[model samples]
Target: MSARHAASPGRRDEGRAQPAGGGDGEYTTYYGRPVVKAPPWEVDIPAYMFAGGLAAGSSLLAAGGDLTGRPALRRAGRLTAAGALGFSMVALIHDLGRPERFLNMLRTMKLTSPMSVGTWILSLYGGPAGLAAASEVARWAGLRRGPFRLLAALDRPAGVAAGLTAPPVAAYTAVLLADTATPSWHESYRELPFVFCGSAAAAAGGAAMILAPADQAGPARRLAVGGAVAEVAAEQRMERSMGLTAEPLHHGKAGKLMTAAKYLTAGGAALSLLAGRSRVAAVTAGAALLAGSACTRLGIFEAGIASAEDPKYTVVPQRERLRRGQPVRYEG
Candidate 1:
């Protein structure tokens, strides 16, 4: 046989593949080829994630305010939700690079496509949220004479309808990311949904606190605290589950962002509880919460990128699977 076709006596497979033993055993690669492809998503993707989550969480808060006789909180929550949804849509279209191509997403539905489902959710969510927010503005500006009054009467019902979709909106982005081949993201699928939900709640509540009167901001503060707790708890669980695979989350640009997010989110939650007496403190807390939420999404995105770019992450895991006689291909 020619040198190129020569095989080593130690190999057993057709190509005489080198054995990649499991449990701390050394592994090999085919040249320097990357086993998994990195996502092409840019900053706009994470920005859309944050904005969509905020919109969803705020819509739920607005519904709660409507039922609780908190007009200031209701108005603030609904307006924020509607405005965030608008901005999110713009960012998504901008990222797609063509408005017409973006519209093509609505042309067909695929049960297997998370993006398709998310697009439909956004389309359905926008109408009720926008109408509710507009009705709030008309009522606040003393336009309760004509159609404004008619619109205002639909506020509660519309807010309720929007609220019904909020939880999924705040959570589906996690599924979208986790469904990918990115190692860190896929591995954390168990906890990412809850983490996003908690972050969303905190962002919505913090924004409401900043805009609503102190007397009406009680629920917002409480939500912030509860969300912070859940976020921290879920993140901890996720990291623990990752084991050595989570190294990307603690040793690079992603690490720095995650650390900052943790501190800012925790500090903001603390300040929110004590912000009842000082407007400045409330604003500070709100700003921190918003920043922290942004950091969390960016950090997760960066970690996924880091994991995908590194070939070792892909090879080692699959080698381990092979040694254990597990299927090398992903089913879903």
Candidate 2:
């Protein structure tokens, strides 16, 4: 068939269905083939994403606690942050299959590679977080003398350094995901960072609120509320901005998770505000926020996978780009 003829549309009476991708009346793939391979990532990947963000945000909370002289909050935040980082590392290495392969990522640093940058951020974040947590343990164990004294003295500074890196550490995963061939992730890059950041904050805050004494947990509660607000707002804006690309987030398995996240987070935030001096209410809110944060990460990860598996998302967008005279670089 001639190129023009192939590109031309046939009558609906002829049983030819219209392309749903909104392309310029052209088929871009081989019989609607997927343009990119869906990620072979397992549940561990989103678990890593969630744990890393929680660690980063908790590190920041630890720093805040140190600066504000909230010993209980600092102790809780530092331990929680360090523990989460350890889990994040394990999850990442688990996803990489071989532990040695995870080490290979440290061989070189590349500004363009989000994975490289994220690896470095995690490493830098780990040192300070570990030190702070260790210092707290030593102090609690009555070993705060000589070398331990120095560690105790430097804990605040180390926490501050971790805090400095925490925001990017929490947010870099979004960039890592966006720098992929997945249509949903790439399309939502603008909002993903904010979404991750807010989720991280909420997770960390929730942890702190649960572990810290109520008197010292005020900041944690506030942070949870603020983070929940940011998360909800960013998600709503992202869906609106994504237009048709947002379908996966609102349908199927991914949709169910997101819907649950919305309700859980909103309820948690509301409860945090209403639970004045009520321990039960505070704990409930914390649990809800933590669950909501996990749901958000899983939902987003699944949505990306769904988008990649669906050929319409890949072919239609590229076909439209071709019609617009834009360069189409296929992902290998």
Please give the CA lDDT of all the candidate structures. Answer: 0.83, 0.83
Candidate 2: TM-score?
0.90
Candidate 2 — what's its lDDT?
0.83
Deviating ranges (above 4 Å) for candidate 2: 1-33, 323-325
Per-residue CA lDDT of model 1 for 1-332, tens digit only, reads 12112222334344322435423343333453344678888999999999999999899889999899988888889999998998888888888999887679899988898999888888788888888988888887989887777897897889999989889899999999998888889889999999999999989888988999889999999988888889889999999986656879997999999999999899999999887998998989988998899899999999999887664565456557789999765321
Tens-digit per-residue lDDT, 278-327, candidate 2: 88888898899999999999999999998877655665566577789997
Give residue 304's error in model 2 in angstroms.
0.4
Worst 10 residues of 1 by lDDT: 1-10
lDDT of 1 at 152: 74
Sequence-dependent TM-score of model 1: 0.89
